[model samples]
Target: MRAFFKAFHYAAKGIVHSLRSERNMKFHTIALIFVTIAGLLTGLSITEWMIILILFGGMLSLEMLNTAIERVVDLVTTDHHPLAGQAKDVGSGAVLVFAIISAVIGLIIFLPKWF
Candidate 1:
């Protein structure tokens, strides 16, 4: 039980560290806040809310993973290397792909209602 609580503490600490150090994380968080408010205002359906939540979670998770990959690549190679660059680029690409998909989902969910 004690270890389980400590695990949550460590997870929160990592999230805080990432949010503080990663500009993209901050942007994603702000976007999430706005989206949540929009959802509330629009009275999103249960299914829509679930989809939004999943999209938000997917983007945030991918962003975190990208940050971790970049950090690991940096740590592994202080000097420039093609493979390290590729690793970071691929991680960022994954995040970009998810962000684009999330945006499309958001449009599908909110655009018709607003317009």
Candidate 2:
């Protein structure tokens, strides 16, 4: 039980660190705040709400994973290397792909109601 709780604590710590240190994380968090507000104002249906929540989780998780990958790559190689650059770029690209998809999905869900 203690170990499980400790794991949660570490997770929370990592989230805080990411929010504090990562610019992209901060951007995503701000986007999440706006989405939450819009979701409330739009009076999202249960299905829409579930989809939005999943997007939120998926976006944030990918961003964090990207951050982790960049950090690991940095730690592994202080000097420039093609493989390290590729690793970081790929991680960033993954986050970008998810962000684009999530934005499209958000528009699909919210645009009709807004207009």
Candidate 3:
């Protein structure tokens, strides 16, 4: 039980570290806050809320993974390398894709109601 609790502590620490060090993570968190506010104001249905939650989770998780990949690539190679660059680019691209998808879903859910 203590080990399990320690695992959660370590996970929280990692989240804090990423939020502090990663600009993209900060942006995602800010977007999450805005989305939550919008959802509350719009009086989102249960299904819409669930979809938003899933997309939010997906975007944030991908961003964290992207950060991890970039960090590991940097750690392994201090000097410039084509493969390392590619790895980082792919990770960033993944986060972009997820962010775009999340934005589109948000529009789909919120636009009609607002306009």
User: Best-fitting candidate, measured by lDDT?
Assistant: 2
Best by TM-score: 2
RMSD of candidates 1 onward, in order: 1.0, 0.8, 0.9
lDDT of 1 by residue, 1-115 (tens): 9999999999899899989999999999999999999999999999999999999889888999999898899888899999999999999999999999899999999999999
TM-scores for all predictions: 0.95, 0.97, 0.96
Clashing pairs in 1: none
In model 2, the runs with Cα more than 4 Å from the true position are none
Error of 1 at 33 (Å): 0.9
Residue 41 deviation, candidate 1, in Å? 1.0
Candidate 3 residue 14 Cα shift, in angstroms, is 0.6
Residues 4-110 of candidate 3 have per-residue lDDT tens digits of 99999998998999899889889999999999999999999999999999998898889989988998998998999999999999999999888888899999999
Q: What is the C-alpha lDDT of each candidate?
A: 0.93, 0.96, 0.93
lDDT of 2 at 17: 100
